[model samples]
Target: MKEYLALFVIIAVFLYLTYTIASLPGSDGLPGNGGYISDEVWYVTSARNILHDFFKTPANSPYYTTTLDCLTNESRIVKEYVNINAVTVTGNVKCYIRRGFPYPDKEGILSYYNFEHPPLAKYVIGLMEAIHDEPLFWRIPSMVLGAATLILVFLSARRVTGNLWALAATALMIFDNTFRAMSGIAMLDIYLAFFTALLVYLHLSGRLLGVGTALGLAASVKYSGVFPLFGLAYLYGRRGVWGFVAVFLMAMSVFTLVNMPIAGQLGIQRWVHEILAAISWHTTSRPPGPIASNPLDWLCMHNSFALYTSPDIYASGTPAYLVALVYALYKRDDVSILYLSTYGGYWLVYLLGNHTLYSFYTTHFSPLAHILIARLLSDIARRK
Candidate 1:
C-alpha cells in the first residue's frame, strides 16, 4: 500500500511539473496565433461570472443572446466564445480581460456576459475569482486539477493492468500538447476530462457508486460528459435493467440538482429550447468571421478557427470519426475498445443529431482516448 501511495505521489508531481512547463507563456492557445484558439478567453470570462454572479443573467454573452431582438430567436450558443473587453501586458507577455457577468445593468447590446454554456465551468472559475481576483488565478486550479487527472489515469491504469502499461499511458498523456494546453487553462475541459476518466477508471475497477458520483460531477462540468453514461449502460446491462436504471437515475439526479436551482423549473424546460437554438445557430449562424467557411475544410487544414468554432456548424455532415467508432465497436470486448466506441459514439451522436462540432468538443472523448492510446502503446512495447 505504501509503495502504491508513493508511486501515486510521484506520478502526481511529475504531471504537475509537466503541465506547468507546457503551460508557460506562448503555450496557451491565444487568438491570431498558430495552435492558439480563441475560445479560452470565453471560458475565462464564464468562469469569472460564475464566481461573481452565480444567479444573475449573463452579459456580453458569447454563447447566447438574450437581448430583446434575439431573446425569442432560436439560436444555439455554439462557440461559448468570450469577448475580451481588454488586454494588458505586465512585463513581456500580454494578459486579456474578457467581459464577464453580474454586470451593473443590461445596456448597449447586452455586452456584459450571458449564458453561452451551463454554469458549472464558470462555477469553477468563480472559485478562482474568490481566491485570486485575477485571470491567471482561475487558471491555477485547472493546472492543479489537470495534474491530478493524470495521477488518476496512472493509478487507474496500474490497477487495471500493471505498472509498465500504466507508466507508458501516463507519459503519452503528459506529453500530448492538446491535453497540456487544455489543462493549463481555466476552462472546464480539463475538469470534465479528469472526472470522465476517473469515472471510467472506477467503473472498470468495480466501484459502481464511485462511477455514478464521478459521472454526475463530470456532467455537471459540461453536458459532453453525459456520453460515458451510455457506456455505463452497456456495462451494466448484463447485470439487470434495474441496476442500470438505478445508477442512471442517481447520476441524473446529481446533474439535475446542480442545475435546477439556478435554472428553476422553467429553466429545465428552457434547456431544451436553448439546445434547439444552439443547434440551429450551429448550422446557420455564421456571422461572417474568419470561421465562416465549411467546417470540413477548416478542420482538414488544421486551422485555429476549426478548433475554436461552435460545434453547431462544424458537425453538419458525417465525419470520418463515425467510421472510426464503428470499427472500435467491433472490438468492444477490450476496455480500450469500449473507450474508443464511447469516444467515437459521442462524436457521431452529437454530429449527426446536432449541426456542429467544436475543437473543445473533441475534448469530450479525450479521457477515454488517452487511456486507450496509452494502453495500446503499452501492448506494442511488450510485443516488441
Candidate 2:
C-alpha cells in the first residue's frame, strides 16, 4: 500500500511539473507548430523530412512550414530554386499543410540532412509526426518515454534500497534540470537516457538479452552509449571472454538492425559508409563553441547548455546530488565508482582529441547515479 502511494505521488509530481513548465512563456515558435527548443529545430525537422522521404505521409493534411512557397511560371521567377534540407527542390511548392514533416530531400538520401546520427529516434519522432506534424507532436514521444523512465528509475532503485529510496531517486530525477529539460525537448539525449536507464535496470536485474538490447538501442541513439556496451560486456566477462565478444556482437547486431532502414534506402554499401562517416563525425571535434563544454565540466554541473529561454532551461547536473555522489565514492562505494567511472570514457574522448563536449551528455548516466546515490543514503539510514 505504501509503495502504491509513493508511486502515485511521484506520478502526480511529474505531471504537475511538466504542465507548469510547458505553460511558461517560452519561445512558442510560429503559431500552430509549437515551440522549437534547443535542437528541436534540427531533430524535429529531420523527423518530418524522414516521414516525407520514407512515406510521403501525413499527406495533404494541415501542417505548416516556414519554407517559403516557390513562385512558379505564373510568377515569372523562371527557374529559381529553393535549397531545402540541402537538396534542390525544383518547382516544388507543396502545401505545408500536410500534417507531416517537410517535403523529402530531393536526393532521396532520406537523411534529411541530419544523417550523422542513427535514425531510430527520428523514426520514433516520425511516429508522432505521422499523427500530427507539429512541434508538440514531435515532442510528445520524448515526454511519454521520460514518464516511463521514472518507473525504470523506481524499479532499478528498488533493487538497491527498496521502495522508499527508490521513490527518493525518482523525485531527484523529476527535479534535476538536465533530466527535466531533455524530457520535454525533441532531441536525441532523452532517448539515449531512456535506454541508459534501461541498461541500469537490466544490469541490476541480471537479464542478458535485455542488457544487450538496451546497449544497442542506447548506442543507436548516441555513440556515448557505446561506453556502457563495453562496460556491460566486461561485467558479463565473469562468464568468459568469448561470452564478452558474443555479447558485444549481439549488441552491435541490434545496432545494425536499427540502421537497416537507412540501408534499405541508401543500399548496404552506402549505409556502411554512412555509419563509418558518422563515427568519424562523432570522434572529431571543431573549435570550442559557446555551447560545448568539456566532459569534466559536467562533474559539478558547470557550463550548462541553454535549451530554452524566457526563464532559461539550462541543461546541467544537480550540484548537491553530485556532491553526494563524490562523497559516496570517497567511502569506497563500489556502485558509485562503477557508475562514475563511465565518465572515463568521455575523458578518453577528450584526451583523444575531441575537446568540444556538452554537459547535457551527462543525461547518459545521471539517472543511474541518482538511483545509486539514493540507495547509498538509504543504506546509511539503515546503519544508523
Q: Backbone clashes in each candidate structure, one number apiece?
A: 23, 6
Q: Write the per-residue lDDT of candidate 1 for residues 134-253, one digit (tens) a residue.
A: 435656777777777777777776765577666666666654445566665566777887887788777777877777887888878766677676667777887888767877877877
- Identify the runs in model 2 with alpha carbons over 4 angstroms from their true place: 22-33, 56-61, 64-111, 324-338
| lDDT tens digits, residue span 203-309, model 2 | 77877677778888988887777776545555666567875676577788999898887688889888888878877777788775658888767776788887767
> Under the 3 Å rule for N, CA and C atoms, how many clashes does model 2 have?
6
Q: For candidate 1, give the lDDT of residue 133.
A: 40
